[model samples]
Target: MTDVVQNGQAKRVSNSAIFAGCAVFVAGMVGAAYASVPLYRLFCQVTGYNGTTQRVEQYSEKILDRTIQVTFDANISSGLNWEFKPARMVNPKIGETIQIEYTATNRSPRPTTGSAVFNVTPMEAGAYFNKVECFCFTEQTLQPGETVKMPVVFYVDPEIAKADETRNIKTITLSYTFYPSEPGKPVAALPEGNKAVDKKL
Candidate 1:
């Protein structure tokens, strides 16, 4: 009888260990996907983790013969009534500098200010992505119906071609999401399917 009890206890412990392993595996799979912005600023700016692009001043020293398509995407989080978008796409050679623009207009009846957070993908590409000039994190205040153009200057590092993890990338996407510059409000993920709104008052 004691042997039977001991065997049952061992089986229960084994099952508990299996369950804990499964939980850990699931958590690992979901690592930082929900961390969104600010995390990019705090933990990713230097290391470029979670697809956060690096900021630099000088242009790349070496331009490559290879070209990669760079795409742009924009989003507006809640509490901001602004329309923003990039100026389409460009295929830039590795280490070659390029400049692009994004237009933003206040759609609200009153003046509003917004800030931007940016990142790039296939996650690992962040370490190789470099931006020279950007309007991110700056407060832009526009009067009612006021529109303004913002430019971004950036390039992909030539070292990307040599890095084993990013060498195969053919396309990279640079994305930004704008949020209200209201003090004390926490930044959050953008809502789906609402890039441009007819919410003009």
Candidate 2:
């Protein structure tokens, strides 16, 4: 009887250990699923995969005479009540930095915050498009009936003219879509001393 009881106790302990191991495995999988999105985004940004452009502090001083036409597109998702558009189309020489403004107006009666997701096309051109400064880098908040002008600084890498796939590409379109931020996330506050312009569209 003593031997039988000892065996039973050992079996119970083994079972508990197995159950704990399974629980830990499941928890790890859940954590990995949550982390995958940001990890993939980081990977794309670094490799310029999927038309994701690279962010740069500055470009080379040499400007190639090859020019490319850049078109801008702005969109607001279903829940965001705002009017957005690019100021104009621009054509710039490769490696020459250019700045442009986008205007957005909040039509809602209450403060609204938005974050933008952007991409460049055609896909091959993404690896060559570099942005120095862009509004898409941060979340934007607009007060009721407020209108704001945002700027983007960018350049086409001169190396693009050497890439056989994109060398002859004449135009690239940069598109941005604004969406409501996730719930409970902190909304970025507007810069101090900048009064909201109550210009409703």
Candidate 3:
């Protein structure tokens, strides 16, 4: 009877240990699942994988003699009643900073808000496409029938002409998509009474 009691206690402890181990593993997996998205995004931003462009505060260090045709593309998510378009194209000397603009008009009778997400094409060249200033990542709200112009100042890094993966690339396309913002979300602080307009842009 003494030996049996000891075995039963040991068995219970073993079972408890197994359950605790499984619980810890599940918790870890759940945490990892939650972190995967931001981690992947950071990874993409760092490596310029999947056409994720780089954001820079200052102008390029140098400008190359060769010019590259940079094109613009715009898109609006469904349910957002807005007309969005970008200037067709511009040729800028490598590393030359230039500003291009996009126009957005709210067609709905009621006010609406939106946020823009952007990316670059020729995924390999994304690493060299840099934005000095952009209206993206900000909530934009528009009054009924309002039109506004948004600007993006950007430059192609001169390193594009030297990187083995991007050398010989002649064109890069930047694209944006606007999605409707959820109600009750914070609106961007615009100058009082600016209808879909940003003076800084």
Tell me the lDDT of candidate 2: 0.81
The TM-score values for the models, in the order shown, are 0.71, 0.87, 0.83
lDDT of 2 by residue, 94-122 (tens): 99999888899899999988877888899
lDDT of each: 0.80, 0.81, 0.82
Highest TM-score scorer:
2
User: On residues 91-172, what C-alpha lDDT tens digit does candidate 3 reach at each position?
Assistant: 9999899999999999999999888777888999888888766777467888899888898888998988988888988889
Judge candidate 3 at residue 3 and give its lDDT.
100
Better of 1 and 3 by lDDT: 3
Candidate 2 local lDDT, residue 115? 77
The candidate with the higher TM-score, 2 or 3, is: 2
For candidate 1, the 10 contiguous residues with the lowest summed lDDT are 190-199
